[model samples]
Target: MKRDINIFEFPLNLGLKKKEHEIEPGVRKLPDGFRKFDFHKEINPQNIFRLDAPDYSMEIDQESGVLNAEGIIEYAKEQADFISENHKEDAFNIILGGDCSILIGTALALKKLGNFGLFYLDGHTDFIPAHLSETAAAAGMDLAIITGTGHEKLTDIQGLKPYFLEENIYCAGNAETDDDEYVQQIIHSDIHYFDLYELRKNGFGKTAGDFLKMVYSKALDGFFIHLDVDVLSDELMPAVDSRMDDGIDYTNLREILKPLVHSPLCFGIEITVLNPDDDKAGSYTQPFVKNLIQIIKNKED
Candidate 1:
């Protein structure tokens, strides 16, 4: 059956510390970036819906470099619940996020719906604790929080511990870096961690095929897809708070995502951490939006 695709936006920069190349995380300008694309005119209004999201900027913790994780959790939870309550079971969702921490609420909403898994694609493991957060971006800790590994406030959201089991999660394209110790944590944990290098070695198409099988086998209520823009190569997407020298390319991302999103078990998707400052003249936003449009359209067909 063809499903409705609704869009929601969370424009803020709750993550980021010092800038590189003065590359600030101006997530607040994300909606504006898309506006340049005139998304409303491009897609059919009958199939696309919009949400009246918060219209203000949130202050980041000067020392922590991330907005208060707990505080954002409370707010994001409400947004997720609202979508769950208002949308149909088959409605395909595309959430535009300020940062990856948005997953805490998304996972919680899935918890309320029933058993669900997570498909995480990013540049870093995001397993750092409060003390080990080198830049203090809560986005960096979202994965650990979703797995019920960190802070009680996040781990215990809606009284759901380990919201997504390690077996139910398939994290692809997480490139290694020397700046964080999260790599060691993933090596020791039960999470299905596939580095960008390994994915390329095994081939993204082959690995994505195998990964989807794993997710379907473990999922009772399907799964959610989280795409952190930083997963793409620095040369292609340098708009993130953290950049990796090597990573997945845009063409490779589409190949990996197309089949998985076409699966019946794929419930929704959230794309986060795209800094507009780096995307001058809608160069990146235009193509990104085009890909998403095709992805959503393919889901209905």
Candidate 2:
């Protein structure tokens, strides 16, 4: 079936205040020397799809560890409805996120349609419960909340059990500064962990090929690919809340994702953590967006 694609942008910064950054309107404008890096200039009319998340007010309470859970649920419901309506027409949902927490809503939406596998690409595990989180950031608990392991309001947003089984989850290129307990949790969880050192030694092409094969074998249906900018090397992608120096490099990322982008089982892709504050006058973000668009367009062609 021919695929219809929708690109949705969630721009709120509710999850980042704890990290000391501020949010602003509009795409971060490129500085004088960075003007040549605009990614929108390369858009292909035929294969591209776009949408924007509703502008809901957001607040973060560090003392109480309470996020606007109700608002998040409402936003998630809207996203779920959009996906359900579009799925009937054979369309794919490509979400650009405000923060990693957006995954909770996206995953909830996907779960409503039946079973789907998650390809979570990030530097951190994102499995910490709200109470235990050092930073108490909502983004930290995104994956756990969707899997029904956190607060009731966050976990029960979709009126279902955990979105997917732990066995069905896959994390690629993780190189976080997690504590020992977090490390043990990753080692113990059913989620397969492919460390950065392994990818470097085995080469991204080989590593990604093996991972995709494993996913396809286990996934009876299709899967969604979620990309967090923090997964990229800090040198190349400085526009994220979590900047790890030893993460995947741009070249390796392209190699790792190309096969999956073209895979029949790959339903959609979500790109997150495009924090304009950390970016150098949009210097870092434009090229990354260009590469992502190119990857998707090449697959379409």
Clashing residue pairs for model 1: none
Candidate 1 Cα errors over 4 Å, as ranges: 18-24, 45-67, 299-301
Residue lDDT tens for model 2, 1-301: 2455655555544444444234342222222112246443443222332335445334654434646555666667776666565553355556666777778767877787668788788888787677777666677777777777777777776477687667777777778644777766667778777777755787778866776777768654777888887888888887667667878776777787887777777777777776665665667776776677667667332
- Output the TM-score of candidate 1: 0.87
Per-candidate clash tally: 0, 1
Error of 1 at 114 (Å): 1.0
Give the winner by TM-score: 1
Which 10 successive residues of model 1 have the least lDDT summed?
48-57
